[model samples]
Target: MKVCLVGSSGGHLTHLYMLKPFWQDKDRFWVTFDKEDARSILKNEDVYNCYFPTNRNIKNLIKNTALAFKVLKHEKPDVIISSGAAVAVPFFYIGKIFGAKTIYIEVFDRIDKPTLTGKLVYPITDKFIVQWEEMKKVYPKAINLGSIF
Candidate 1:
Protein backbone atom coordinates (compact mmCIF):
# COMPACT_ATOMS: atom_id res chain seq x y z
CA MET A 1 0.00 0.00 0.00
CA LYS A 2 1.24 3.47 -0.83
CA VAL A 3 1.36 5.85 2.11
CA CYS A 4 1.61 9.61 2.32
CA LEU A 5 2.99 10.95 5.58
CA VAL A 6 1.95 14.58 6.14
CA GLY A 7 2.75 16.86 9.06
CA SER A 8 4.30 20.13 10.07
CA SER A 9 7.95 20.37 11.07
CA GLY A 10 9.35 19.57 14.52
CA GLY A 11 7.08 17.73 16.97
CA HIS A 12 4.36 16.99 14.49
CA LEU A 13 6.92 15.62 12.09
CA THR A 14 8.49 13.51 14.82
CA HIS A 15 5.16 12.02 15.76
CA LEU A 16 4.59 10.74 12.24
CA TYR A 17 8.16 9.50 12.02
CA MET A 18 7.63 7.35 15.08
CA LEU A 19 5.24 5.24 13.06
CA LYS A 20 8.10 4.00 10.91
CA PRO A 21 7.37 0.44 11.90
CA PHE A 22 3.99 0.70 10.21
CA TRP A 23 5.22 2.52 7.10
CA GLN A 24 8.71 1.10 6.68
CA ASP A 25 7.72 -1.57 4.21
CA LYS A 26 5.19 0.43 2.30
CA ASP A 27 5.64 2.58 -0.77
CA ARG A 28 5.62 5.96 0.94
CA PHE A 29 6.45 9.64 0.62
CA TRP A 30 6.37 12.65 2.92
CA VAL A 31 4.76 16.08 2.80
CA THR A 32 6.25 18.49 5.29
CA PHE A 33 8.11 21.74 5.74
CA ASP A 34 11.48 22.19 4.09
CA LYS A 35 13.21 22.74 7.37
CA GLU A 36 16.49 21.44 8.71
CA ASP A 37 14.98 18.58 10.68
CA ALA A 38 12.74 17.43 7.90
CA ARG A 39 15.55 17.70 5.36
CA SER A 40 17.89 15.66 7.53
CA ILE A 41 15.41 13.02 8.72
CA LEU A 42 13.72 12.49 5.38
CA LYS A 43 16.86 12.64 3.27
CA ASN A 44 16.41 9.09 2.07
CA GLU A 45 12.67 9.39 1.45
CA ASP A 46 10.57 11.02 -1.22
CA VAL A 47 9.53 14.40 0.21
CA TYR A 48 7.35 17.31 -0.86
CA ASN A 49 7.58 20.67 0.87
CA CYS A 50 4.35 22.54 1.43
CA TYR A 51 3.76 26.20 2.29
CA PHE A 52 4.17 26.97 5.97
CA PRO A 53 3.25 29.62 8.61
CA THR A 54 0.00 27.79 8.12
CA ASN A 55 -1.68 28.49 11.44
CA ARG A 56 -4.32 31.18 10.84
CA ASN A 57 -2.47 32.20 7.70
CA ILE A 58 -4.93 32.47 4.88
CA LYS A 59 -2.38 33.02 2.11
CA ASN A 60 -0.31 29.99 3.02
CA LEU A 61 -3.41 27.94 3.44
CA ILE A 62 -4.45 28.76 -0.09
CA LYS A 63 -0.99 27.99 -1.36
CA ASN A 64 -0.96 24.68 0.48
CA THR A 65 -4.39 23.80 -0.82
CA ALA A 66 -3.05 24.20 -4.34
CA LEU A 67 0.03 22.24 -3.45
CA ALA A 68 -2.15 19.53 -1.98
CA PHE A 69 -4.13 19.20 -5.17
CA LYS A 70 -0.97 18.87 -7.22
CA VAL A 71 0.77 16.47 -4.90
CA LEU A 72 -2.21 14.24 -4.16
CA LYS A 73 -3.03 13.98 -7.85
CA HIS A 74 0.52 13.04 -8.67
CA GLU A 75 1.20 10.70 -5.75
CA LYS A 76 -2.25 9.12 -5.46
CA PRO A 77 -1.26 7.40 -2.24
CA ASP A 78 -3.51 4.72 -0.79
CA VAL A 79 -3.46 6.40 2.61
CA ILE A 80 -2.57 9.80 4.06
CA ILE A 81 -1.51 10.24 7.68
CA SER A 82 -0.55 13.15 9.90
CA SER A 83 -0.03 14.50 13.42
CA GLY A 84 -0.39 18.11 12.42
CA ALA A 85 -0.17 21.85 12.93
CA ALA A 86 -2.14 23.02 9.90
CA VAL A 87 -0.62 21.72 6.68
CA ALA A 88 -2.52 18.49 7.01
CA VAL A 89 -5.87 20.18 6.46
CA PRO A 90 -5.50 20.68 2.74
CA PHE A 91 -3.91 17.32 2.15
CA PHE A 92 -6.53 15.40 4.10
CA TYR A 93 -9.42 17.17 2.41
CA ILE A 94 -7.94 16.79 -1.04
CA GLY A 95 -6.85 13.21 -0.43
CA LYS A 96 -10.41 12.28 0.32
CA ILE A 97 -11.48 13.54 -3.08
CA PHE A 98 -8.80 11.29 -4.54
CA GLY A 99 -10.37 8.36 -2.68
CA ALA A 100 -7.38 7.87 -0.37
CA LYS A 101 -7.92 6.78 3.19
CA THR A 102 -6.76 9.26 5.86
CA ILE A 103 -5.50 8.84 9.41
CA TYR A 104 -5.04 11.75 11.85
CA ILE A 105 -3.12 11.28 15.08
CA GLU A 106 -3.75 14.04 17.61
CA VAL A 107 -0.57 15.32 19.19
CA PHE A 108 0.34 13.76 22.52
CA ASP A 109 0.47 17.10 24.29
CA ARG A 110 -3.22 17.63 23.71
CA ILE A 111 -5.28 15.56 26.09
CA ASP A 112 -8.42 17.50 26.89
CA LYS A 113 -8.77 19.65 23.78
CA PRO A 114 -8.57 18.97 20.07
CA THR A 115 -6.05 20.69 17.89
CA LEU A 116 -7.53 22.78 15.12
CA THR A 117 -6.14 20.45 12.51
CA GLY A 118 -7.57 17.46 14.32
CA LYS A 119 -10.99 19.06 14.51
CA LEU A 120 -10.86 19.97 10.85
CA VAL A 121 -9.96 16.53 9.61
CA TYR A 122 -11.81 14.37 12.10
CA PRO A 123 -15.01 14.33 10.10
CA ILE A 124 -13.32 12.74 7.13
CA THR A 125 -10.49 10.78 8.70
CA ASP A 126 -10.76 7.05 8.26
CA LYS A 127 -8.85 6.43 11.49
CA PHE A 128 -8.49 9.02 14.21
CA ILE A 129 -5.84 8.06 16.77
CA VAL A 130 -5.40 9.70 20.13
CA GLN A 131 -2.36 9.38 22.33
CA TRP A 132 -4.36 9.78 25.52
CA GLU A 133 -7.59 8.16 26.61
CA GLU A 134 -8.99 11.52 27.68
CA MET A 135 -8.85 12.69 24.11
CA LYS A 136 -11.55 10.17 23.31
CA LYS A 137 -14.03 12.48 25.06
CA VAL A 138 -12.96 15.16 22.60
CA TYR A 139 -13.12 12.70 19.77
CA PRO A 140 -15.58 9.97 20.62
CA LYS A 141 -14.70 7.82 17.62
CA ALA A 142 -10.98 8.13 18.14
CA ILE A 143 -8.89 5.09 18.91
CA ASN A 144 -6.78 5.32 22.05
CA LEU A 145 -3.37 4.22 20.81
CA GLY A 146 -1.41 5.82 23.64
CA SER A 147 1.71 7.83 22.98
CA ILE A 148 3.65 7.37 19.79
CA PHE A 149 6.68 8.86 21.48
Candidate 2:
Protein backbone atom coordinates (compact mmCIF):
# COMPACT_ATOMS: atom_id res chain seq x y z
CA MET A 1 0.00 0.00 0.00
CA LYS A 2 1.22 3.48 -0.76
CA VAL A 3 0.74 5.60 2.36
CA CYS A 4 1.31 9.30 2.87
CA LEU A 5 2.24 10.20 6.44
CA VAL A 6 1.36 13.89 6.80
CA GLY A 7 2.02 15.93 9.91
CA SER A 8 3.98 18.86 11.26
CA SER A 9 7.43 18.66 12.77
CA GLY A 10 8.28 18.01 16.45
CA GLY A 11 5.88 15.70 18.28
CA HIS A 12 3.74 15.07 15.24
CA LEU A 13 6.77 13.86 13.30
CA THR A 14 7.86 11.80 16.28
CA HIS A 15 4.51 10.09 16.48
CA LEU A 16 4.53 9.38 12.75
CA TYR A 17 8.03 7.93 13.01
CA MET A 18 6.82 5.44 15.60
CA LEU A 19 4.36 4.06 13.07
CA LYS A 20 7.06 3.72 10.37
CA PRO A 21 7.91 0.19 11.34
CA PHE A 22 4.41 -0.96 10.58
CA TRP A 23 4.82 0.18 6.99
CA GLN A 24 8.41 -0.88 6.47
CA ASP A 25 7.48 -3.25 3.71
CA LYS A 26 4.91 -0.94 2.18
CA ASP A 27 5.54 2.16 0.10
CA ARG A 28 5.22 5.17 2.39
CA PHE A 29 6.00 8.85 1.93
CA TRP A 30 6.35 11.66 4.46
CA VAL A 31 5.07 15.23 4.10
CA THR A 32 5.79 18.13 6.41
CA PHE A 33 6.96 21.73 6.38
CA ASP A 34 10.56 22.28 5.30
CA LYS A 35 11.99 22.66 8.76
CA GLU A 36 15.50 21.52 9.70
CA ASP A 37 14.38 18.90 12.19
CA ALA A 38 11.77 17.57 9.80
CA ARG A 39 14.27 17.38 6.96
CA SER A 40 16.88 15.67 9.14
CA ILE A 41 14.57 12.91 10.31
CA LEU A 42 12.99 12.29 6.93
CA LYS A 43 16.25 12.52 4.98
CA ASN A 44 16.43 8.83 4.20
CA GLU A 45 12.79 8.58 3.21
CA ASP A 46 10.60 10.07 0.50
CA VAL A 47 9.59 13.52 1.75
CA TYR A 48 7.45 16.32 0.36
CA ASN A 49 7.83 19.89 1.55
CA CYS A 50 4.63 21.91 1.96
CA TYR A 51 4.43 25.43 3.30
CA PHE A 52 2.46 25.90 6.50
CA PRO A 53 1.02 29.23 7.55
CA THR A 54 2.05 31.03 10.71
CA ASN A 55 -1.52 32.26 11.19
CA ARG A 56 -4.38 31.96 8.70
CA ASN A 57 -2.51 33.78 5.97
CA ILE A 58 -3.78 33.94 2.40
CA LYS A 59 -0.35 33.55 0.84
CA ASN A 60 0.20 30.34 2.71
CA LEU A 61 -3.19 29.11 1.64
CA ILE A 62 -2.24 29.69 -2.00
CA LYS A 63 1.10 28.00 -1.46
CA ASN A 64 -0.58 25.06 0.23
CA THR A 65 -3.07 24.75 -2.60
CA ALA A 66 -0.25 24.52 -5.12
CA LEU A 67 1.66 22.13 -2.91
CA ALA A 68 -1.44 19.97 -2.49
CA PHE A 69 -1.74 19.67 -6.24
CA LYS A 70 1.90 18.70 -6.54
CA VAL A 71 1.50 16.05 -3.86
CA LEU A 72 -1.62 14.59 -5.36
CA LYS A 73 -0.06 14.40 -8.77
CA HIS A 74 3.33 13.01 -7.79
CA GLU A 75 2.72 10.77 -4.78
CA LYS A 76 -0.73 9.42 -5.46
CA PRO A 77 -0.77 7.59 -2.15
CA ASP A 78 -3.44 5.00 -1.51
CA VAL A 79 -3.83 6.02 2.12
CA ILE A 80 -3.07 9.07 4.24
CA ILE A 81 -2.41 9.07 8.01
CA SER A 82 -2.02 12.29 9.91
CA SER A 83 -0.98 13.26 13.47
CA GLY A 84 -1.03 16.97 12.98
CA ALA A 85 -1.40 20.56 13.95
CA ALA A 86 -2.24 22.59 10.79
CA VAL A 87 -0.59 21.15 7.69
CA ALA A 88 -2.79 18.09 7.93
CA VAL A 89 -5.85 20.09 6.96
CA PRO A 90 -5.01 20.51 3.27
CA PHE A 91 -3.54 17.04 2.92
CA PHE A 92 -6.54 15.38 4.53
CA TYR A 93 -9.05 17.04 2.24
CA ILE A 94 -6.90 16.46 -0.82
CA GLY A 95 -6.52 12.81 0.09
CA LYS A 96 -10.31 12.47 0.43
CA ILE A 97 -10.89 14.17 -2.91
CA PHE A 98 -8.47 11.71 -4.48
CA GLY A 99 -10.41 8.79 -2.97
CA ALA A 100 -7.63 7.71 -0.64
CA LYS A 101 -8.36 6.12 2.71
CA THR A 102 -7.74 8.77 5.36
CA ILE A 103 -6.76 7.98 8.92
CA TYR A 104 -6.53 10.58 11.67
CA ILE A 105 -4.59 9.94 14.86
CA GLU A 106 -5.32 12.44 17.58
CA VAL A 107 -2.10 13.85 19.00
CA PHE A 108 -0.74 12.53 22.29
CA ASP A 109 -0.79 16.02 23.81
CA ARG A 110 -4.54 16.28 23.25
CA ILE A 111 -5.72 13.94 25.94
CA ASP A 112 -8.05 16.39 27.63
CA LYS A 113 -9.27 18.27 24.56
CA PRO A 114 -9.58 17.49 20.89
CA THR A 115 -7.22 18.98 18.34
CA LEU A 116 -8.94 21.08 15.67
CA THR A 117 -7.75 18.81 12.85
CA GLY A 118 -8.97 15.78 14.74
CA LYS A 119 -12.45 17.21 15.04
CA LEU A 120 -12.52 18.59 11.51
CA VAL A 121 -11.41 15.39 9.82
CA TYR A 122 -13.41 12.98 11.97
CA PRO A 123 -16.48 12.74 9.78
CA ILE A 124 -14.53 11.96 6.62
CA THR A 125 -11.74 9.88 8.10
CA ASP A 126 -11.77 6.16 7.53
CA LYS A 127 -10.26 5.52 10.98
CA PHE A 128 -9.85 7.70 14.05
CA ILE A 129 -7.25 6.48 16.53
CA VAL A 130 -6.69 8.08 19.90
CA GLN A 131 -3.90 7.60 22.39
CA TRP A 132 -6.07 8.42 25.34
CA GLU A 133 -9.19 6.52 26.29
CA GLU A 134 -10.72 9.74 27.57
CA MET A 135 -10.86 10.99 23.99
CA LYS A 136 -13.54 8.42 23.24
CA LYS A 137 -15.91 10.64 25.20
CA VAL A 138 -15.34 13.42 22.72
CA TYR A 139 -15.19 11.18 19.65
CA PRO A 140 -17.20 8.07 20.35
CA LYS A 141 -16.14 6.38 17.11
CA ALA A 142 -12.39 6.66 17.79
CA ILE A 143 -10.36 3.55 18.49
CA ASN A 144 -8.05 3.70 21.50
CA LEU A 145 -4.58 2.68 20.43
CA GLY A 146 -2.89 3.67 23.65
CA SER A 147 0.20 5.49 22.31
CA ILE A 148 2.31 4.50 19.34
CA PHE A 149 5.31 5.98 21.12
Candidate 3:
Protein backbone atom coordinates (compact mmCIF):
# COMPACT_ATOMS: atom_id res chain seq x y z
CA MET A 1 0.00 0.00 0.00
CA LYS A 2 1.13 3.54 -0.67
CA VAL A 3 1.89 5.49 2.49
CA CYS A 4 2.51 9.15 3.13
CA LEU A 5 4.70 9.43 6.21
CA VAL A 6 4.73 12.97 7.56
CA GLY A 7 5.76 15.01 10.59
CA SER A 8 7.92 17.95 11.59
CA SER A 9 11.63 17.64 12.26
CA GLY A 10 13.18 16.64 15.62
CA GLY A 11 11.31 14.29 17.92
CA HIS A 12 8.16 14.21 15.88
CA LEU A 13 10.09 13.03 12.87
CA THR A 14 12.09 10.73 15.11
CA HIS A 15 8.95 9.02 16.32
CA LEU A 16 7.76 8.70 12.73
CA TYR A 17 11.08 7.20 11.80
CA MET A 18 10.60 4.51 14.44
CA LEU A 19 7.88 3.15 12.22
CA LYS A 20 10.34 2.58 9.41
CA PRO A 21 10.45 -1.13 10.22
CA PHE A 22 6.76 -1.25 9.39
CA TRP A 23 6.59 1.11 6.43
CA GLN A 24 9.99 0.77 4.83
CA ASP A 25 8.87 -2.15 2.77
CA LYS A 26 5.74 -0.39 1.64
CA ASP A 27 5.43 2.08 -1.20
CA ARG A 28 6.01 5.28 0.71
CA PHE A 29 6.97 8.93 0.50
CA TRP A 30 7.43 11.58 3.16
CA VAL A 31 6.26 15.14 3.84
CA THR A 32 8.22 16.99 6.49
CA PHE A 33 10.32 20.03 7.32
CA ASP A 34 13.61 20.63 5.49
CA LYS A 35 15.66 20.52 8.66
CA GLU A 36 19.10 18.98 8.89
CA ASP A 37 18.07 15.79 10.69
CA ALA A 38 15.25 15.10 8.27
CA ARG A 39 17.49 15.70 5.29
CA SER A 40 20.16 13.52 6.82
CA ILE A 41 17.87 10.60 7.66
CA LEU A 42 15.48 10.76 4.76
CA LYS A 43 18.26 11.54 2.29
CA ASN A 44 17.67 8.40 0.26
CA GLU A 45 13.87 8.55 0.44
CA ASP A 46 11.23 10.49 -1.45
CA VAL A 47 10.74 13.54 0.72
CA TYR A 48 8.59 16.60 0.27
CA ASN A 49 10.00 19.39 2.40
CA CYS A 50 7.45 21.84 3.79
CA TYR A 51 7.51 25.26 5.48
CA PHE A 52 7.77 25.63 9.24
CA PRO A 53 6.72 27.94 12.15
CA THR A 54 3.27 26.34 12.00
CA ASN A 55 2.40 27.32 15.57
CA ARG A 56 -1.03 28.80 14.84
CA ASN A 57 0.31 31.29 12.33
CA ILE A 58 -2.55 31.81 9.90
CA LYS A 59 -0.34 32.68 6.96
CA ASN A 60 2.01 29.73 7.36
CA LEU A 61 -0.86 27.37 7.97
CA ILE A 62 -2.52 28.55 4.78
CA LYS A 63 0.66 28.08 2.83
CA ASN A 64 1.30 24.64 4.31
CA THR A 65 -2.31 23.67 3.75
CA ALA A 66 -1.96 24.42 0.06
CA LEU A 67 1.23 22.42 -0.02
CA ALA A 68 -0.46 19.57 1.82
CA PHE A 69 -3.32 19.58 -0.67
CA LYS A 70 -0.98 19.57 -3.61
CA VAL A 71 1.16 16.74 -2.28
CA LEU A 72 -1.78 14.58 -1.28
CA LYS A 73 -3.32 15.03 -4.68
CA HIS A 74 -0.16 14.00 -6.41
CA GLU A 75 0.83 11.10 -4.18
CA LYS A 76 -2.64 9.70 -3.53
CA PRO A 77 -1.44 7.65 -0.63
CA ASP A 78 -3.67 5.03 0.98
CA VAL A 79 -2.48 5.96 4.44
CA ILE A 80 -0.99 9.16 5.89
CA ILE A 81 0.75 8.92 9.23
CA SER A 82 2.47 11.51 11.44
CA SER A 83 3.86 12.13 14.89
CA GLY A 84 3.60 15.88 14.86
CA ALA A 85 4.74 19.25 15.94
CA ALA A 86 2.43 21.59 14.02
CA VAL A 87 2.73 20.69 10.34
CA ALA A 88 0.69 17.50 10.80
CA VAL A 89 -2.44 19.60 11.32
CA PRO A 90 -2.97 20.70 7.75
CA PHE A 91 -1.77 17.41 6.29
CA PHE A 92 -4.07 15.17 8.35
CA TYR A 93 -7.19 17.32 7.97
CA ILE A 94 -6.74 17.87 4.26
CA GLY A 95 -5.67 14.30 3.60
CA LYS A 96 -8.85 13.12 5.34
CA ILE A 97 -10.92 14.98 2.77
CA PHE A 98 -8.97 13.19 0.10
CA GLY A 99 -9.82 9.77 1.68
CA ALA A 100 -6.42 8.82 3.05
CA LYS A 101 -6.47 6.85 6.30
CA THR A 102 -4.90 9.32 8.73
CA ILE A 103 -2.92 8.06 11.73
CA TYR A 104 -1.48 10.36 14.41
CA ILE A 105 0.95 9.01 16.98
CA GLU A 106 1.08 11.07 20.18
CA VAL A 107 4.63 11.81 21.21
CA PHE A 108 6.41 9.88 23.99
CA ASP A 109 7.44 12.94 26.00
CA ARG A 110 3.94 14.22 26.69
CA ILE A 111 2.60 12.84 29.97
CA ASP A 112 1.18 15.75 31.95
CA LYS A 113 -0.54 17.33 28.98
CA PRO A 114 -1.56 16.84 25.36
CA THR A 115 0.09 18.46 22.40
CA LEU A 116 -1.96 20.93 20.37
CA THR A 117 -1.36 18.88 17.25
CA GLY A 118 -2.75 15.79 18.99
CA LYS A 119 -5.89 17.62 20.06
CA LEU A 120 -6.41 19.14 16.63
CA VAL A 121 -5.76 15.98 14.66
CA TYR A 122 -7.75 13.64 16.95
CA PRO A 123 -11.18 14.49 15.65
CA ILE A 124 -10.28 13.89 12.04
CA THR A 125 -7.80 11.08 12.52
CA ASP A 126 -8.57 7.47 11.74
CA LYS A 127 -6.35 6.05 14.45
CA PHE A 128 -4.90 8.08 17.32
CA ILE A 129 -2.09 6.07 18.92
CA VAL A 130 -0.88 7.19 22.31
CA GLN A 131 2.50 6.25 23.72
CA TRP A 132 1.39 6.63 27.32
CA GLU A 133 -1.61 5.40 29.26
CA GLU A 134 -2.02 8.86 30.76
CA MET A 135 -2.82 10.10 27.31
CA LYS A 136 -5.70 7.67 27.06
CA LYS A 137 -7.28 9.76 29.82
CA VAL A 138 -6.74 12.84 27.67
CA TYR A 139 -7.76 11.14 24.45
CA PRO A 140 -10.31 8.59 25.61
CA LYS A 141 -10.79 6.99 22.25
CA ALA A 142 -7.06 6.71 21.63
CA ILE A 143 -5.35 3.35 21.39
CA ASN A 144 -2.67 2.78 24.00
CA LEU A 145 0.05 1.12 21.97
CA GLY A 146 2.73 1.92 24.53
CA SER A 147 5.91 3.87 23.82
CA ILE A 148 7.28 4.30 20.35
CA PHE A 149 10.73 4.97 21.80
Off by over 4 Å in 2: none
Candidate 2 yields a Cα-based lDDT of 0.84
- Winner on lDDT between 1 and 2 is 1
Judged by TM-score relative to the true structure, which candidate is superior, 2 or 3? 3
For lDDT, candidate 1 versus 3, the one ahead is 1
Error (Å) of candidate 1 at residue 148 is 0.9
Candidate achieving the largest TM-score: 1
Please, what are the lDDT tens digits per residue for candidate 3 over residues 1-149?
Answer: 99999888888888889897999899999888898999999999999988877887889899999999999999999999998878899888889899999989989989858999999999999999998888888999999999887
In the range 1-149, model 1's lDDT, one tens digit per residue, is 99999999999999999999999999999999999999999999999999879999999999999999999999899999999989999999999999999999999999899999999999999999998999999999999988787
Measured against the true structure, the TM-scores of the candidates, in listed sequence, are: 0.98, 0.92, 0.97
Ranking by TM-score: 1, 3, 2
Identify the superior model by TM-score, candidate 1 or candidate 2: 1
TM-score for predicted model 2 compared with the true structure:
0.92
Rank order (by lDDT, best first): 1, 3, 2
Model 1 accuracy (lDDT, Cα): 0.95
Tell me how far the alpha carbon of residue 46 in candidate 2 is from the true structure, in angstroms, after superposition: 1.2
Which stretch of 10 consecutive residues in model 3 shows the poorest summed lDDT?
49-58
lDDT of 2 by residue, 59-92 (tens): 8767776777788778889998888867777778
